[model samples]
Target: MPELENNFYNKNLKPLARNMRNDSTKAEIRLWCEILSGKRMLGYGFRRQRPVGNYIADFLCKELMLIVEVDGYSHNFKMEEDVKRDAQLQALGFTTLRFSDREVMQDIENVWRTLEFWIFEGENSLS
Candidate 1:
């Protein structure tokens, strides 16, 4: 079982992180991490540079099955790709959220507030 899980991680996650290593969103990613470090909004423990099937997310909360992506202006051109990816993730029962780099970098407190609201709102709604 351990070997199987190890193989799965290598096949699915490691490659994706490799591709995102020099990604353009690093600064925004760091800012998000900083905000997440002390926040209770993650709903569970937050993992940085987490690997899921064939992908690497900027932030992941396994218990919440949540993936947060911070997009730069360039993401406007990749709506189709994002849609496709989100669909697959949703099909797997993950809730995905996206915030623009500008939002996180310029006014990060707002980002934390929004995330906190979403986390508690979702929990209350589900209950």
Candidate 2:
């Protein structure tokens, strides 16, 4: 039996998510190839470009109820949208973590540590 269920997602969005996965950004590719793929996040499974609710998450670990988003320069102008997206995800019982593209490219170790803390230690710390 699966340990977690993805009841918050929209089935219709799967096609869009698949398309996004096919044309991933540089940051998304780097993160997936170097860290999040191959069940590498402490043996957790992560799916790239998954839709939850009305939005497509950058990356999702259903078991952890965690969404990891890699933000590029465009995100600077999309703060409002990002905030709204985060709130919607939060409403559906998921946590969203955002990291800058520079951070993922230049300081992946720190990103890994942050993810580790969130997955293993920070769940109880959420308000």
Candidate 3:
């Protein structure tokens, strides 16, 4: 595994990230436990509340440079900010996948399929 640059992992965010993990939203918990944890997503590892640049991603797959975000109710009003944040992450070579709280809560199977499709497409592009 290639070492991630120091800038991508902000030490100052460690405490905040930990707190977020401890108090995860329902959607976050479901996604992590069911799909992301223990390399369950096609054997790809994921870290929850991982700090990247100045932002904390809900779930990060370092090997794939993928960041999965579970947005809750407040996200509806922060769409612009989210877009900009995603752009910044993209500049850092991370693909951001955003899902609403309702989507993850009510239709997780679809979410899994979406993630699987993205991973397969990404792998194919690499090959």
Against the true structure, what is each candidate's TM-score? Answer: 0.76, 0.90, 0.97
Candidate 2: worst 10 consecutive residues by lDDT?
1-10
lDDT of 1 at 81: 89
Ranking by lDDT: 3, 2, 1
How are the candidates ranked when ordered by TM-score, highest leading?
A: 3, 2, 1
Candidate 2: residue 91 lDDT (0-100): 88
After superposition on all CA atoms, how large is the RMSD of candidate 1? 3.7
After superposition, candidate 3 runs with Cα above 4 Å error: none
Best by lDDT: 3
Candidate 2 per-residue lDDT, tens place, 1-127, comes to 1423546878899999999999998889999998899999899999999888899999998888899999999999999999999998998889999999999989999999999988778556764
lDDT agreement with native, every candidate: 0.70, 0.90, 0.95
True-structure lDDT of candidate 2: 0.90
Model 1 earns a TM-score of 0.76
lDDT of 3 by residue, 1-127 (tens): 4467564988899999999999999999999999999999999999999989999999999899999999999999999999999999999999999999999999999999999999999999999
- Quote the lDDT for 124 in model 1: 96
For candidate 3, the clash count comes to 0
Better of 1 and 3 by lDDT: 3
